[model samples]
Target: MMRDQAESLRNMVKKNRSVDFQVISITSGKGGVGKTSFTVNLAYILQKMGKNVLILDADLALANVDIVLNEKPKYNLLHLLTGEKNINEIIWSSKYGIKFIPAASGFEELANLPKEQQMFILNSLQDIYYSFDIMLIDTSAGISESVINFCLAADKTVVVTTPDPTAVADSYAICRIISNYNTGNMELGLVVNMTDNEKEAERIYNATNNVIRKFSGKTIKYYGCIRKDEKLSKSIRERFVLTSRYPNSKYSQDLEIVAKAILEGNLPEKKENFWRRILNNWINLKFD
Candidate 1:
């Protein structure tokens, strides 16, 4: 009887442990660089690692994260911000363990709201503070004020770019804007996507780092690279995450690495929970 009682107490203790939510924002140097794809896949990978995650399609205009997952968002963040509904009324579940807070379509005026309206929106985000293990924000493509605000508000930012010169330049420009104006302590992560090989991706990352150091005086750390794999496009067309639908694909492996790195954070002393430790072990096992 005493042994059973102890086991019950242990189970209760485990159940009492609260969830920790971290906000991660993914942006790009420009549009058509696959930021939403990265965001969705990364969040899916994190969910696979036994963590509860949230994907906020903060891409006010042309939001496609929902469409990619074949979901129709009934309500979005804007609706909650405008007092039309609460967060619980809008967030949708995914096939993966992650939840989604999609943006309301055709809400152009919400993006250009006055300072009062913007503050209301920012305040509303606080409602889901404890509801997720991580909040992944996939912002719009441009470096507009709204995007800047979302980047600054996020706990961390992951900048997506490709080997193309124009994409590199535009990514660096966004990094400069955040460094100069971000109020939150948002550490930047760089992901070089759609590359043929690691060597080329590394070259692009190194060159961009140099440019940022020289011109912006801010250092952008490397997260990981997503290889150019035909399976990535096919998986998107199928409306499933590469990790889920094409687990053996190179793109999925690369995204898993990047997701692990982001969850680990920058400082060595930054502690991770059981899910993160499981993720680290899983990645190491994959490469082995």
Candidate 2:
């Protein structure tokens, strides 16, 4: 009887506990799909839900997470890599409780970073890996070497898209590239942004997955959809997060639904720290 009681207690504990860490990459097939906006606002929503969140502006050349948050970062990963700044010095904490790490621009984002440089980043961010419940990597759009590596290395990857044909094609392109690189069952999701209605959004997702089925067996989860809302654009112009500034906006509410879907989904199996997994993926990415 005691053994059965102890077994039941263990089951209860297992059910209550979540993964210690989760790394999700917010990527797009092409630019102008509102990927960064989703990243920042989603981080805010996650923070409000009592989870510590970190946003890594991994767009390489064009880092915009800071701009979306209305923050001009004085230091980025390049500074940390050069020993010009410490880990704590470069992180920009928002008033909403999430942390932001902007990427280095210009020469620093060129091509794939050197292995040594990659290791420098891994070492520098070691502390941060333990401090946050989740790290949202806002990767640059397209299937560039670095971007592909970022998407694949993540525990979960959400491909943001619009209902436009080109956007859908581009979204499929990235999903195809990802599947080509890793033939495993990756935890991939789709977020349709800038849609006029839910049906339109679901149609885009279904069509994209239908094509993805041709070249690869992998399918993407339909997290949720965001309707086209002028408030989001206005909030960005004011350098404020839409969800934080106007929580009741349709865009914000849609994003909250997406965030809840993500949190409710099955987390991908991961056994190592995010940076370490990134380092390994970096080694595998072949630059042109």
Candidate 3:
């Protein structure tokens, strides 16, 4: 029975290839919850597991994932949105085998793009969307219209929160907001960041789930939790992804599990695409 269920899950992921290409938007109710860190490391982890991943610096207000990787992007999502550059022209390969489209900086007006421009941006983004297996967007924190629009467009929405009471409360609020637009079977995952242990993370997840269940009759499943660690900050200071620079580190190990969970959710059948494998191998070798 367990094997049959696993096989069924894998088949479902294999058959449901749609547009927007599995946008996993990582957002937090408030800032400083390690949202960007989670996004960067998670993208790296997915790449390590042989998946073609694209990390978009969707946090237009304060884009820093490129900086965290100690990289200086030539172009950003804002440039793509404004027709300043093409998508392929702006994408740069990270050393960790993940391709990134950096968000253009110094754009206070980026969040308020006009409707026609917004549609154009979306269409341009969709043009090369299927080129990768996963498109992860590290969105700006908080419940702004920009954040809501990104979440709604994504197939999976991941909300990051810590073990703080206020953080938990805000997470519930975010979940309620997403629930309003999610009609049926859109997978929403939670990442409990900066926790002491799995028990603490589960406690936080349960607490937020309780609030969501009572208030909105919805349940937010956890993708995974990232433990609070000094090495994470240390790696940031060193200007490298923890998974690539410090694979033996605890944070790297946890991120590996998180990556596996994400892959399990998305590619349950474990069928390998020959072209993707060949392409990703070539890309990884070049970047490495």
Q: Could you say which candidate leads in lDDT? A: 2
Worst 10 residues of 1 by lDDT: 273-282
Residue range 241-280, candidate 3, lDDT tens digits: 8878788888888778876776556431223322222223
Using TM-score as the measure, which candidate wins?
2
* Local distance difference test, candidate 1: 0.72
TM-score of 2: 0.87
lDDT by candidate, in order shown: 0.72, 0.78, 0.71
Model 3 reaches what TM-score against the true structure? 0.82
Model 2: lDDT to the true structure: 0.78
lDDT of 1 at 2: 31
**Between candidates 1 and 3, the lDDT winner:** 1
| TM-score, one value per model | 0.81, 0.87, 0.82
